[model samples]
Every structure is written in structure tokens, then in C-alpha cells.
Target: MTNPTVAELIARSNRLGADPANTNYAGGNTSAKGTETDPVTGEPVELLWVKGSGGDLGTLKPEGLAALRLDRLRALVDVYPGVEREDEMVAAFDYCLHGKGGAAPSIDTAMHGLVDAAHVDHLHPDSGIAIATAADGEELTGKIFGDKVVWVPWRRPGFQLGLDIAAIKRAHPAAIGCILGGHGITAWGDTSDEAEQNSLWIITTAQAYIDEHGTAAPFGAVRPGFEVLPEAERHAKAAALAATIRGLASTDKPMVGHYTDSAAVLEFLASEKAPALAELGTSCPDHFLRTKVKPMLLDLPADASVEASIARLIQLHEQYRADYAAYYQRHADDASPAMRGADPLIVLVPGVGMFSYGANKQTARVAGEFYVNAINVMRGAEALSSYRPIPESEKFRIEYWALEEAKLQRIPKAKTHQGRIAFVTGAASGIGKATAARLAAEGACVVIADLDLEKAQAAAAELGNTDVAIGVAANVADADGVQAAIDATLLAFGGIDLVVNNAGLSLSKPLLETTEKDWDLQHDVMAKGSFLVSRAAAKPLIEQGMGGDIIYISSKNSVFAGPNNIAYSATKADQAHQVRLLAVELGAHGVRVNGINPDGVVRGSGIFAGGWGAQRAATYGIKEEDLGQFYANRTILGREVVPSNVADAVYVLTGPELSRTTGLHVPVDSGVAAAFLR
Candidate 1:
């Protein structure tokens, strides 16, 4: 028997969606444009056509199919700002569609553009959606596909989404395709038939799972019971909840707006659910990854004061952070530092649903969706049996799995100066000297900016590579000197890659005894110097395209108010805030700004030798040597974290390895703060 042709398979796939109810208009579309471009020929090529937008696969037509230039589409994989330049991108689509004139490209044009396969097919399979919509979908997915399929959790579809898909394709070149959780499935093949078959296989597999597990009764039927409050009372209750959530979230994004007059949601909230509605995540884990596992739950009696209720909520959040830290440590092995790090999970309100938080928008959205899904699954599972989530230990393992850790690990290692020039303030000794050495080791051409020209040059000579290291003497607090230093850096190495705002003086004086002169002097060297240097380097870093990294070496005292070091601590705190604001502003441009709060990086210069250390040690009733040991012993790790430890952290953030991380204040104080308080 002759094999079915591409036309036959396309027809078969279309026929399978013939039922009008199954193929809702505008709900599903198919396209036959093989919109991939050949890298070598630079000519139009056709492999397999796809269904155009708004055309149901059930009745797709040849005219509905846009025959595309495969090579041209492939070329788009490497495009930048992806679809942020929609006009140009859409115009390219127009050219791809028309040759001279073709049918408009599918709405999933970017999706098709990213795939390298000759034939591609996409569908919002109902069964697939049903399965994806479940809370434990990931577990169910594992049970169903085992290791056969790759699952991409829900992500907003567009340019970035396409980039993510392209990355996945590159990583799993052999994957038949992928299932986008909470969205749909994508199947690609050497031939159109195989792609369609894979799509069918995924849908049928999901259908089989649904048949075995049974469908959830409509929410209205299984909905838990709750008191129907008066409209005025409901409004008051919701307002209180919203205020609590906003206070915890530090955002006013109308989280509680969705719950106003929402009795069904309110019922879910006020129910006697085991996990408590606030503790349950959103519809999916993706949401949890962003909003966290819970939101602030305000369960005070109606007569309770709002201020008091808020205080209780803050206390709850503290407890949540503590619990999460304990949970992380309980399951994490000794091997991974990442496992030991603290990340905000979910914030929960007693009578409200959870809200997740993450480092960025994409992560936040994923967390929200995941939370919603998790809630739905847990509620549904309750009907079948007890809704037992995976053991906390298991959740911890999954959360901190080596594979996930690997994703965090994949950050680009700081490249050897890859067009990045760095200016290290106070580069002669202590943490500044170590930072300069670390940056040089990572390939950044270094400019040792210091007050002492001789010592700076000596430090540069010690680095040994004259080609990569240059020494310059300048008072960082002087605006003109900073400008000159920046100019010199540009002349030596085309552009600046990083700046170590590590120059500062630590004065030990009680707040009452700190003279105005002393305060101003401390600020001049630390805060003013940082501002001057950063202002000078900003333009060049922005122009470099590859975002720049700035590391402000702050102090643990910034977070914890330490006696007799008020001047030094206040400036460090301001520096940390400066980095935070910088991160928020510079993030859009790819530049990352963060701080390293090191406790006691012993080894030469700065506060340690300036008599300040001895004074601080005396005040604390300990000798200088004992002060270092005291801090080390006060940490969870019980290791004396050296200047190199702090330097390594700076390198991690500014280097390639932590490209996605920014606006973070990493404590390199051997977890001293964690030991002392939170």
C-alpha cells in the first residue's frame, strides 16, 4: 500500500476536527505554511504548508494554507527584540506569505518561525487543555507520558515565548514536540502526517487520563458552602483583604478586585479546607513560582481593627518565611549552595487565596497560573479522596531538583572582559583588592581607581597581565576625577563592563558622638563616590548592548542596625537601596545592578586597620581576633567567609553565570543575618 501523502494527512487531521462543537470558531486555527528559511541559499523554499489564522482544521482549505519560505522563517529564529518590532516582523511575515502575495500568516507565526522542523502543527486540544488546567498536571503528565514528552509550563505567547521554544528545541533536539501547560500542544515532524499523528497521540493520551480519573463536577455543584454576607459587609471584608494583600505584596495590582462580590470565590475562601484556601496556590504551580504559595490571609473577626489585623498578617509572613527556610534546609543536601539559598515562595491569607512572587514578570505570571491550577486540582482531588499534596520533602526535592538547579547554574560564567571594562574603586587592598583580582580573573579588563597612585600601580603589577589591567589614581569622591577615570577606561578597553563600588571608610562612633564632619566624610567616600563613578560609566554601559553589572560591596550592618557604626551602616544601606532602584530602572536595558553585603572579609586595609575595628571589637567586649570568630560562629555555615568569598559572589552576579539575576542583595556574611534574625 502506498503511504498517505501530505495532502491526505492534512485532510485527515482537518476531518478529525469536523464536529463544530469540538472545533469552536476562533478557538482553534490551523496553517500549512512551512515558514522556515534555509540559512545557506537565502531563497524561498516550501516544505509543508500550515492552516492560516481563524480557519478551523476541520475545514481547512488549500487557499487557507499559506505556503511559506522555510528558509525565511528559519532566519527569524535569530531575530532580536523578537516581535517587539511587530511592524517590521509582521511585514516580514507579509513578504513570507505573499512571495509577491500569499495568505496572511498564522497568528502563531512567531511560534512557527522558531521551529526548525520541515513540517509543524499546533492545536489547542480540548483534552490537553483539560489536563493542563488541573492542579497536579505536572504529576499527571509524568504518569502519562513518563519521559516521552517535554512539558513547558504556561508562558505568555509572543516573541519571548518563541525564544523560549527555540531554546527548548535546541536543548531537546529529539523531542517530538512539547506540551505547553495551561495552553496547548505543539507537534513537529519530518513530514506533516507525523506531526498530526503526534498531536492526536497527545490529545488521546490526555483523553485517556480524563476517562480514568473522571471529569470534575462543575464548580457550582461541588462548591463548598459559605455565609452569604450583605453587600455592604462583603465590600468591607474585601477591602480589608485587599489592604492586607497589598501590604504584603508591596503592590497595588488589584488582587482583591477579582474577589469583590465573588461569593463562589468567597465560599472557597471561608471554607474549612484542610490546607486553608490562602495556603493553596493559584490554578497552577506556574503562578506559585511568581506570586508565591500563598497570599496574606486576613481572618480577624469583623470587629477587629484593621491595623491589628495587618500586624497579624505581617507576623504570619514572618512565620511563612521561617517555615519555608526550614523546609528548604530539611530537604537540601550538603552539596549545593543554591539549595541553601532562601527564595520567597507563596504568601497566604487565612480567608484568601495565595499570591506568588518571583524575580521577574515572566516568573511571576508562571507562579500565578501554577497556583490557580494547584488549587483546582486540590479541590477536585478532595472529591475523589483526601487531597494530599506530595510530601513536603518531595515538594522540596522537586523544587530544588538538580535539573532545576542546573537551569540556575546555566548562567553565563563571567566572560574574560568580553567587551567589558571595569573600574574598581579603592583597588589597593581588602575587599576592593580582592574584587579587582576576581574581575581580572574573569576576563574583565580592570582599571584600578585609587587615591594612592603607587599602591594602585603595584596592585595592577601584582595582577601580572598588563594587557588586561591598568592602574589609575583618582579620588572617587571627586566628580571630575571620576569622569577622567571613566574616560581613561574607555580609551584602554572600548567600553566598561562592570564597576565595583567598593571604596569606603568605616568609622566606629555612636550616633550621638558621630560629628557632622565625620558623617559627611563617610558619605563622601562611600555614597558620593559610588554616585560619581556610576554616573560616569552609565552611558558607556548602556551603549554596549550586553548589559553591564555593578556590584556595591555593602555591609551586614546595613540590614541590622549596629551600635557605634551608624555612619558607616547608614551609607551602606543607602548604597543597597541605590542598587535596588538602579536595577529596577536599568533592567529594561539588560543591565543588572546588585549589592554584596559582606560581614567581615578580613585581610588588610579599610575598617580593619583604621582603629575602627579595634574600637568596635572593644565595644562588643571581644578582642579583634575574637570578633571575626564571633561572627563566623554566629552563622549557620560556621565558616569564616573571607574577602575571596565575597569576591566570588560579586563575580557571580557581574559575570555571565548570573545573567538573569539582578536587584539582589546577596549576603556573603556566612549567613550571619540569617543566624541573628531572619
Candidate 2:
């Protein structure tokens, strides 16, 4: 039988975690105590169920809870080795499982199990953290909550801190929760509902107090030269600087990126106090872990030219890296894990916005979100009292902790396309859509660009939405449209690693019957479009200093000299030659240019469905429905080619298997001997 307590705990966690104000993502834990029948002995046993390590409360499930025997957990108190060897306690948790533990116990498990309350919640709410991080947090707690909440001074979260909180609870019988100095808040209740209400009250009350008492300028006055830029200009500047910033951030490894000009971010960056606050770094461990100890702030004024800003950024990054290495050296001991990397994860620019980087897009975006939480915390802290966080030494201890290193080691190996961003033109349907799906499945962040914005967004949504994919409208034939699409890609994912030039249409008329308009339109969309996309993407690819892939979806008609396909065949030929031309020109920069020559991709094909199938069937003297089989039967392998076939060819060419091969055309036409490269 399921324990009702665990179910209620899940509900409470979801309610708290669903709102950003309640806590930053995955930054808290919740627990419930209940009795369950042991399957082995048929004995009633008390168990503690708490949110497991690395689980996000908002999306938490039954499996996300770690179930431990309450008696066994409390027994460890007698053998507690003190704070210095606290990490070893984490290993001992495996022995305390109620049955097969539901999930791995987190460091916070001690706090939940040792407390007397039936339900408990530990949260990193921005408002609560604001009060918790204030310089006079103890004094502020008394002023705000009176006897309802008590103050617990700074202590790294471990077995000792858990014991301290338990002692605090016993001492203050009337206290429902306590604010941990330089951290967040912890609340408790005899019932699940009471626990949730207590947590919410603490959060809302802190916010209310700050609202009433906080000064008008929490972050100090907006600096004269750092005012937020106009919206259009702000975004344009962000797009322009994205590539250079991304390149600098990827100093350690290739990273996917995210850009935000949110009001909070813009306001903070434009304020006079931002530099000092950012330097103090974040108070909460969760904040600095994702955002790094602190962000690298650009010193240039908001109105500085892009070139000048980029130039200064180059110099600043070198200093930031050096300073980070020195800090690591200052704190690292013989036992500490190696320095992870010197690169900054979050970068702040006054007047523009913030850019964050990680191995993937979600990680990057979340880092940026965490920084915003920090920003809010700082705002409230400054308003209520002078902002004060834990010392730099404490932050260094948490950043390089051995237990944290173990967690990092447990993350699954990266997929083949991980950290790579792919841009697919005309990706809303047909071969382009199939290609986008394949790339995304293999862990590439995809941009589905098409003439139809609605279909493009729908396609992107199917591939996991903004986390791993985004949709953009691009009329590839127009230079402006193509450039805009490229800029959007940069803003969304930092830099491009792959470009698939697949946007095209066909007109199956003979040279004599093909109108001049038909010739120009086909050439404009295929030949000219491919060139424009390639040209626009090349600059960023080169600027990023990372090798890239450019694959063209040319047709078999490019080489087969097929009848009644003059306009389409010529455009494809133009694309095929571009592969060779660009391969030579870009080889020096490690950018590979390749082409996929597919024959008669009829089923589920946008071009075929849009009248090309009927026109081709008429020209071939065959029924439109039998055109696929007709083309298949003519091939040596007698296999009908589909969009996925072309997609497979694309994956193969860009994949590691063909890393050294470029300027080559691979056929997906089931043995088209005539179309085979000679």
C-alpha cells in the first residue's frame, strides 16, 4: 500500500517548486515521515522520504524520493564524526535504505530525518534568501517574524548543521521555521499542509517586509552611461556580440548558449551597484555552482562600438581566467578535486543583456535563470539591509567539494552530437524536417527554419521545444531574411556547428516550356538561397574558431541530366558545384562542405506533394500514384527513396565517421549508377 504522507509530500513539493519565487530550479528538498509495513518481516517501520540528490521538485515523482529507515538514520548521530568528515556520511546513506531505496539520498537527508516534525521543507526562495543573506540577518529575522521564526547562523550544510537545526527546533518550541544565515529558509509542521503554509508564510512575509522597508533604489541609481538601450537596439547589439562572447566562453570546451534581456537583468546591469554586487558573488551555493563563483562583467559602456567592446572583452577574459585559477589555487588542498575549468559560465554586459554558456542549452539557460534569482536576492538584501554573503573561502570549499565531484562523474556520457547546434533551412516539412528530427534525437540543438512560421514552430515543438530546438522563419532566397535567421540562431544557441542548406522547390518543365519566371524562381530558392545561407553562417562559424559542417541537399538530377527538369536540374547542379567550391575555400578553417544527392524523394515530400509528382509522372508517361515504384524499379536496387533516406545520408556525412571526408556527394537513391560520382 502506498503511503499517503509521501503523496502529500510530492504535492507540497510541486506546489513550492512550480513557482520560481518559491525556489530556484532543483535548489531545495522536502520530506515526510510515515510508517509502512516491511514486506520481508511484516513489521511496521518508520521511514523518512525526502527529495533525492539532483531531483527537481517541480517535476519530482515517487521514484525521486529516497526512503530511509528513520531509526537507522537517527542512530548515525551517536557515531557522527563531526563536521570535518561530513562527506563520508553520504556514503553511509546506502546502508540506511528502508527497502531498495527509492532514490539516492542527498546531503540534505540528515536535516529531514533528524527533525522532530512529521513534515519539513527546505527551500532557496529568492525573498527568503534575501532576508537570509542580509548582513544583519539575525536582527532582521527578529524584526520581521518575531518569535515565529528563529535565526540559525552560517554553517555548511552537513550532519552538524542538521543537528544544529534540530537543536534550534527543540529550543524554540513556538518556532515554525528558521532562516539559515547566508543560505535560505527551512520550515516544518506536524502536518503536510501546515508545513507548506509555513514555508509560504515565511516567503511572503519576508517579501512583504522588504516591500515596506526597502529603499527606492535597491541596486543604487542607474549609472548615467549604463541605461538600458532601446528594445530594437538592445536585441541587435546582443545578436552582434553573441558570437564573440560565445567564442571566449568556450575557452574550456564547446558550449551551447542562451541570451536574455529580461527586465531584471537589464535593470541590474544598468545600475551603479551591479559591479560590486556581482563581485561579492552569490550567497547561496546553488547560485554560484551554476553561475560559477561570479560572472565576468564587461567594463565598456553600453554605447561603445561593437568592435571596441569585443576587443576589450578579449583582454578581460584573459584576466578573468587567471584570477579564477589563482582563487582555485588559494583554496585548494591536497584532497580537493581538480579545478573544473577557468572559463566563466555567465557573462554580464551593461546596456545589452546577459549571455550564459554550458555544455547544453538548458544548462546555459538555467545558469542565467539562477543568476537572475541571485539578482533578486541581492535587490531585496540591499533594500532591507546591506547585502552580505558567505566568505570567498566557503564558496571555494563548496565549489571543489569531493561529493560534488562524484555527482559530476555520475552524469551520463555525452551523445555524438551533444553541444553542437544545427541549423536546417526549410525544416518544417519533408527531408528537412526529417533531418531536423534525426539531429535533435542525437542531441543536437536544432533550428527549424522555414517559410511558414507556424509549421516551423510545430515541428520544433515535436522535437522538445525551446530546450533542444527552436523555430525561425527564413525566406532563404532573400539576403535579409537569411541574415535574420542566422542572427536568431546565434542568439538562441551561441554559435552554429552545422548548416543544412535544404530549402528548395522544383519545376519539371523542359527548357523550351520552362518560363523565364519559372527558371528564376527555382534558381532563386535553391541555388541563390543555399549561397546566401552559407555566406551568412560562414562568418560566425569562422569567428567562433570552431570547425563546422555545411551540407547541401542537391539532387541526382544535378548529374543524371534528367529530361523535362531543366530549371530544377540546373539549380541543383549549381548547389553541387558550390559544395566543391566552398569545401576548398573553407578547408583552411576546418569547415567541411558536403552534398547529398537523392533521387525521386516522393512520399511525404513537400515538393512532390506540391505538384512536382504529377508533373514528373506526366513527363515520364506514368500514373502519379505509381511514380515512386516506377523510379524505384528503374534503379539497380529497386528501392523507393524517402525523406528519411536523405536524412540518413545527412547524419552519416556530418557524423564522426566521415569527419575527414568533405567536398564529396553521397547518394541516397538506392543505387543510381548514372548519378554516382565518377
lDDT (CA) per prediction: 0.61, 0.93
- TM-score against native, each model: 0.39, 0.99
Q: Residues 1-678, candidate 2, lDDT per residue (tens digit)?
A: 467888899999999999999998989999999999999999999999999999999999999999999999999999899888989898988889977738889999999999899999999999999998999999999999999999999898888888999999999999999999999999999999999999999999999999999999999898899999998888888888888888899988888899989999999999999999989999899999999998999987899998999899999999999999999999999988888899999999999999999989999999999999999999999998989999999999889988889999999999889999999999999999999999998889999999999999999999995989999999999999999999999999988999999999988898899999999999999999999999999998888878899999998989999999889999999999999999999999899999999989888888999999999999999999999999999998999998999998888888889999989998888888898788
Q: How does model 2 fare in lDDT?
A: 0.93
Clashes of each: 75, 0
Candidate whose lDDT is highest: 2
CA RMSD of each candidate after superposition: 21.4, 1.0
Stretches of candidate 2 off by over 4 Å are none
What TM-score, to 2 decimals, does candidate 1 have? 0.39
Q: Which ten residues in a row have the lowest lDDT in candidate 2?
A: 94-103
Off by over 4 Å in 1: 1-418, 674-678
Question: Residue by residue across 1-678, what tens digits does model 1's lDDT show?
Answer: 312343654575576566422223333444344333455677645644556544556766556656566556666656655444543554466555433333556546767656666555566555555555555666766777766567777654445655667677778876776767655667766676676676678778766666567635422332233334555554444344432343344321211112222333444444556335445433322233334434545455434455675677677666666766776677767853453333344443333343443332223333443444444444444433334333345345435645345545655653544434578998888888888898777666688989888999999899865555779987988998887777666544434668889888877889899999999998998888898888877765664444678888887877887778888988988898899888988888777889988887655756678777788788889988777777678787898877788778887787657888998888887777542424
Best by TM-score: 2
